[model samples]
Target chain A: MGRVVVEVMPKPEILDPQGKAVVGALPRLGFTQFTSVRQGKRFELEVDGPVTPEVLAAAEEAAVKVLSNPVIEDVVRVADIEADAAATITSEGLA
Target chain B: MGRVVVEVMPKPEILDPQGKAVVGALPRLGFTQFTSVRQGKRFELEVDGPVTPEVLAAAEEAAVKVLSNPVIEDVVRVADIEADAAATITSEGLA
Candidate 1:
């Protein structure tokens, strides 16, 4: 199987309260070197076969339609992963 | 300045309702090749300098403490981006 990774992030004009909270909490936690923090969403979809152009297109459509709210958010990145090799086991599982 | 990207995902043992909803919606949307979907969080932190090892460590700590609930989620990946180069402009901005 192949895997498609889609990243969804809020538009720059939108206010991200969760991200703002994290940014606000940082200084209280004693780390104050950051200028800004933007939080978003990531979706990992495992397909039934090797990733192809058609799959990517379909995934993109799904990501735009189902994964994010286009009014306030956008799809930032879409990546293909080889399930047979790099995806069967979690990287943390190895550790 | 530099940037750090942190990806936070639910632990394998934890339940992901948002992911489940997406998986359920895909078939209705005419795309049904996925076995599963896992939704997660991504944080893009813009720092004021180059991303050093210390910066990565601090970002990791913040990701763990402020960004995710360690009881149910985990940090999957931590990436460093160069602010002076590719990070200066959005890839979509060129379009």
Candidate 2:
């Protein structure tokens, strides 16, 4: 089991108006220290199977190329990827 | 520093053709045990300020109402939220 994840955020110079709106709405919702909010995105991918050094590299490359914006978003922070399936899959002669 | 995060997944019955494509692409991309893929979306919210019990509650509500589809996506999993600013902000008499 392998998963690729990414974090996306607005460029530092760009204004995050949606974040601002959330922040502005907070006080009324009972938050006082309202200040700044940066909106971002995350992606979760369930991979074909297993995690190896090469597969890890592959996933990272795929993410950068197709899943995320390199200029606006940071590269993925690989986390808790499993290679071994926890449950046993019993196949009658199909191993 | 407050961030509200949510995880979104497609309804089980709805076909996830994109996920299927990714799974099929894996072997070509160098994964051998290629099996399946489930694609999902994650949302990151930077809150106006500190996360209180009430604020936490509010953010969850907003996420359900506007940020996510309650039926298709699970409620946010609030993690590592912070209220204290790490860097010192020297306010010239603006307390």
Whole-model Cα lDDT of every candidate shown, in order: 0.78, 0.50
Candidate 1: tens digits of C-alpha lDDT, residues A1-95: 87887888899999999889888989999879888999999888988877777887888899888888999999977667443213223322322
Model 2, residue pairs in steric clash: none
Which 10-residue window of candidate 1 chain B scores lowest in summed lDDT? B83-92
Per-prediction TM-score, please?
0.83, 0.57
Which ten residues in a row are the worst by lDDT in model 2 chain A? Answer: A84-93
Stretches of candidate 1 off by over 4 Å are A82-95, B82-95
| TM-score (C-alpha, index-matched) for candidate 1 | 0.83
Question: Model 1, DockQ value?
Answer: 0.39
Model 1 Cα lDDT, one tens digit per residue, B34-71: 88999999899989877877887899888888888999
Q: Output the chain A TM-score of model 1.
A: 0.82
TM-score of chain B of 2: 0.65
